[model samples]
Target chain A: MRIAFGGNQAGFWWYMAAGAVLLLAFAGIGLFRGAVPIDEGDVLAVLARHLLPGERAADPSVDTIVWSLRAPRVVVAAMVGGCLALAGAQMQGLFRNPLASPGIVGTSTGAAAGAVFALTFGLAGTFLLAAPLFAVAGALLSLLIVTRIATRDGYTPVTTLLLAGVALNALLAAFNSWLIARSWEQYEAARRIAYWMMGGVTDRGWVHVGMVLPGMVIGCAIAVWFARDLDLLLEGEEVAASLGVDIEKTKRAVLWSAAILTGSAVAVSGVVGFVGLVVPHLVRLLLGPVHRRLLPAAFLTGAWFVVGADLLARTLVAPEEVFLGVVTAFVGAPFFLFLLVRHESEVAVSR
Target chain B: MMETRGSARRAPRLELVDGGVERRGRWLLRDVDLVIEPAMLTSVVGPNGAGKSTLLRLLSGTWRLTEGKALLGGFDLSALPRRQAARRVAYVPQTVRPTFEFTVREFVTLGRYPHESRLFGTRSADRGWIDRCLDDTDVLALAERRVTTLSGGELQRVLMARCLATEAEVLLLDEPTSNLDLAHGLDLLGLARRLACEGRSVVLVLHDLNAAARFADRVAVLDGGALIAEGPPAEVLNPDLLRRVFRVEAVPLEGSTAPVFDFEPLR
Candidate 1:
């Protein structure tokens, strides 16, 4: 009968500390254990040198590998994971269902389609902004479409939204395939499209980190701003409205912020599945459903989840690296199925 | 016992002037004019699907006024800002099932949202009011219990505590006793009557005519979304009116403090 997260202050802090420690450990493994063998001390020395400007590390080669190659990739991977998880939490709150996520609702695939189009048509030629811009546009457009289709009399039913997302995801994936086929003569473009569809964080640089970090920060801030409203909304739309929450405004802000977060994530790492779905669910399991705690916990857990998954992807096959999306699916699909079965059983038992 | 607290202040009035609601080209309710005054418990009695819930929704400002105006304290309900309207009226629906497991205290604290300035944290002063509301509703013992774990009657009291925490002058409850047993149902009605005596307007949509007649200062009979009769319970609880509005034969038991009707199928 005791309150879990909101009431147990000390326990909540402990949960947060656990998540932080796990994230740091995963980040350490990501930086130290990669294709090139770099010792922990060397990685720390390289970081110290960068911080102090004059402190030199053990080896120049180790510094390059840690700072230029692995560091940026790890940072981007964490950012993408954090963003997707936060977006997923927001989507779940908005829909009032645990099953709702950006990926399930077609936001990620829509962004991927936009980025692929920009890449295939050379619309992003030499401009780092173009691809992300297109991705954001695509994500927002699809979000608007799905919300519009599902909303009736100022309410959006979860089932209708999920169905709309399924149909939209298929249509967008097919369009992406058509674009890929059209660019078959251009081997470079075709190759990029193929890699993007599978999704990865290979060769990612500071530019990608810069592109996503700001969006994540803003999106998270927006999510926190609407956290209380989200809790009231979990009861029902009528109840939320009676509680002084402007349901329409909250819905628009939440959907747009989630779209921006999902778009930035897909722009950097194409359609990394299950981080959005699984990380938030994990956080909810640990820290009840209170968004004030749930949002931050999900962000941290999601970053750790992706960083850890990416580490496994890089080292699991030794010489050959697996795609980030593939690793997530391998781990996430089973977790998702378990969740579905558990949810069904719970529903049955309750009935 | 009915007790009025605080200094004398004019309680707000909620009036519906020919209020009507239409949905998708079908009129759910129409030409309903009513005035809910302070220091009174008004029970709205009706058959199933008689737009009783719709009437409460209109007063709560959740449903739009399709034809007429709902005025709260001389200001148009639809024109008032949401927070302002919420500050004046608190609504407890028939049932609310939260997706998350919020403790009773945490759920009750949500009532202070309109008064709190910050998005996430609660003000220190708000805690006292929350505790007082819980005590008032006799749910203080269940404060730490998860709402999902509470029984139907316990959850109803917790929800009532939440409504009281809003500190609004008017309370609109839709079927507050639908899931309660006889003892709990009477306890809730008693609480509603006491709340009315404290200078708050209490409007309840009820199914049990005897309970409505026992607790309500005034009773309004609604049939087919229209007001058929409105008066004191002594005048409104007659057999003919019951037969006309509810399509039932009412046998009033004698030697009761208040008229209690046992309904039978109309022949």
Candidate 2:
């Protein structure tokens, strides 16, 4: 029943190198193709003009599109994507259940509810600060409620976590629908809400990047800090505690970090489902399940996946952008089914 | 190395005084007074519903004693922070249902969490202890496999190795061999004997009387949540006592090799 592989060091290094290369390649591709569709040389030239003191020889419009508009969007995409992946990884570890994702656990829905509530009530001079604050509060509230219900007698059952998530998701979805239905004067408000729920990085600005970056940084740091404890927790709390882990403390910290990451990502870009769910699995496939390796790779791979998906969203059929979440679903849902089938076959074979 | 030695030198002594634990207004155990010395293998034996596990939980600080105070070392068990208490006593619950799959090495390394740095890496000494624990429990061969893929016996050994990696002075195991086969059960008992022989205090809740009689230095019997008997096997094992305790007739067969029990009564 034991598998001993002697090439672990080589395999691990290769995986890390591959992930870094993929991330860089994807970022490069994303920068080169945009509304103006600058070639790789042109993009590098523009970057050089900004960095070096040479004469700026590019079209001003091209410069604006490449530097101001698209650069910020890509950076925001990477930030939000990395946050979602890290949050997903932490939630999966904290709940000790593979199916435990931010969306399924109601973290994304709660954040979306907060954002919509703020927008509906016109709570800000602008949508700058009010939206993310409401989103964070909503995410924290949902996290507390879910953990309270899921944990009983110092144990949280996987079944209970999923069931609570389903119930909370339904309730929040209904509330969001009600808000949209009740507000008729905003006209395109319903459309905007619907599109946001599908998720995208279009029209993302420096303001969007600023709002989500801090949360992403803080959340990622906390997740990495507790990565070892999370590995133990994935085995079980008793095992973790016997291994000298403060199980309750590790659990609470992981839950908080997951909420922060999910809330901030949703606040900036809306409910991008399944990136948090799918990216980790994909990374686990490429690299093994050591959290030391899994956490960083999942972060970088998720950033690449989201940025690439956004690129496809924008350029798939000219200017009208497709929903980023829709594109992810197109890629993720089928892969999920494939994984389920593959896992079933493996289980069957083991039996 | 230095850390383990320091903790051992300053290790806490445990004392329970007229202590009992209650759940839902029902006393699981009551009016118990006992002192658990350091570095002793205290095996608790009882029938079903005897609250042996509850007493272990209370002593390990997982449950509160309702009547009198139980102190660990000098500090009250209730007053100690959970993390600090965890460093003192390691509790292995009877049933563990892991919801995710983790590798055996990752699982064992978790024992170093309390001694870990904030950056989430283990020291060289901690790593040595972890590997030594795996070697002690004979689970070194399983260091790479996912724990979910392990057999029940292998999983139990892995768990024991996790406890060993903590390097705590006191080890509390609840029904450690309850779900294992004959071979694994014997292996576990041998490991426990070795651990106790190494001067670490070990406490276990056991179902097999023969295993307890063979391996444990001292045996404590719990009935109705009270310590009914505490002594060596020769003093604790009697046909009358066995009848009163387990409702089963046990006839002692004298032999130089080892004492054998012919269990009968129900049939």
Candidate 3:
């Protein structure tokens, strides 16, 4: 395929280099902040003490605070962010529409519904990973329903799929609201569920990290494994099949991967919106759409976006931390509307 | 100005024995018995809804036959792996509107997917075969241009180039000229004729009777889901057969090697 957008002839290495620099820069900035007063060197020392053998920080209590408390929050934020964006890119490719995202596809909302179900129904008391595991089931279920409604004779039209997904998203959100309302009399449960639904990684520890990281990493690996087929699939399924692609097999594998990625992220962080939508679109603008490059770049950029968003969430209000989802929606919703408008006008022009 | 290179690598024999496909209790195509041989440009001519496109799909193995056997070189097409089937039969659809922007080079390179062994051999960029395909289709100059940016005629040539990259023995094209202007349509049909002359079977789903008659070595005429006439252009595309099957009268130009026909609907 030709280089998309033509203006950005800058190759993958340049994108990776620029992205890595910015990601590390934001992550460095993320490491230095918190309710506790920790500087850059202290942050580095805490990291060194954990990663390198026998290295010690000057202040042990500060080390305990940052390493045991603050570090996992930042790490989990990055992982969930990367997974959301990676899933978004795959969704976009699958539907052959840039508008396709985890949020749009109902995966995030479904997971949110499941997590809320766990929290209100008191399944969080059953096991440590109960809520997240339930969220995965919800995500997979919603995706299955939406695809079933949209697919006909092995062909899924973008318009029909989008309509189905949007409907499912609305339905799941209503279900979540019903859960919240039913448990409103339990003051503590309602507040906790509401806060969780707003999406954050505030007190997420290494355990939360362990829970989502493996599944997410494996999902990304599966995505990269089918990267070439993903690229050809952008040409549309019939064409891809003519080029020897196993259309149904490829679709099932990638959708399963996307669902897993979305579920893992939403399981931990509630319904964080649009990092998947915006990050992949931006990456494609810079590096073009060869999934081998697009997937990794989108992951890194998404990680950076959320890490930055989380940093802003904590420090932007200074002690009155904003919801992580609110911060992302503030930035992402406007961009999505712009894309939709552009899409509408393009359709008009084509007609 | 296209150079005709005839490296005919043992073109495969394609035969359809009573092939039929039904959908929703209706036979879109029934009993299509067509034998496609090497070094022949067979134009499948018919009125609208005559199942010309359906026949091409059956031959490409994109759509399966519900009734009879479809074979490529004596092996059942359904039994062959998708990649092996692709290696034997290449298909060019009527219109390709890819939403993603891929370069002409990349688009053509996709044809090499079937030849790539064991799935995941993108490391060795086979520029030789790709460039040769581009050169043959006369789009070497437009290699760097994005496919989305191409004009109708240029993109058609690019599609032909992509098909060439497959190195398949049989080429199935559906309404190749349906979207083109006069000159470009003739140019595309000429390219198809040259490929057939160089020893590969090329089948076309064509609507224009004169264009088909001009280039086809044989014309297979279909009406109401079955083959009505199949032979040399003069025999199959005569005014009487044309009037009966296509419901049109034609002033047949039969003096030249490549004939032309002017037709009007029989009211």
- In Å, residue B115's CA in model 3 sits off its true spot by 2.6
Please tell me which predicted candidate would have the highest lDDT against the true structure.
Answer: 1
Candidate 1, residue B227: Cα displacement in angstroms equals: 1.4
Docking class of 2: acceptable
The DockQ values of the predictions, listed in order, are: 0.62, 0.39, 0.51
- Per-residue lDDT over A1-351 for candidate 2, one digit per residue giving the tens place of the 0 to 100 score: 122222155766776677678767777777787766677777787778887996878867777777778788888888888889888877776766566676667888899999788877767336567877888788888878888999988766656877898899899989998987876577666666666677888878888898888888888888888888777777665556555567777877887888899999998888777889888876666555668777887888788888878888888986777888888888888998888788778778977
Instruction: Score candidate 1 by DockQ.
Output: 0.62
The lDDT of model 2 is: 0.77
Per-residue alpha-carbon lDDT of model 3 for B221-248, expressed as tens digits? 8888998888888777677887788777
Q: By summed lDDT, which 10 consecutive residues of candidate 3 chain B come out lowest?
A: B117-126
What lDDT tens digits, residue by residue, belong to model 1 across residues B1-267?
212233224469898999999988888889999998777999999998888999999998878989999999888999988877887889998986655778789899888777867553777778887888888888888898778778889999888888887788889999999999988888889888888887889999999999988899999888887877887899888999899888999998888878788889999
Q: What share of the true interface contacts does candidate 3 keep?
A: 0.44
Each prediction's TM-score versus the true structure: 0.94, 0.90, 0.94
For model 1, which pairs clash?
Answer: none
Proportion of the native interface contacts kept in model 2 = 0.44
Score each candidate by Cα lDDT.
Answer: 0.84, 0.77, 0.83
Residue by residue across A42-122, what tens digits does model 3's lDDT show?
Answer: 778888888889946468888877887788888899999999999999988888877678667787888888888888988
Using DockQ as the measure, what is the rank order of every candidate, best first?
1, 3, 2
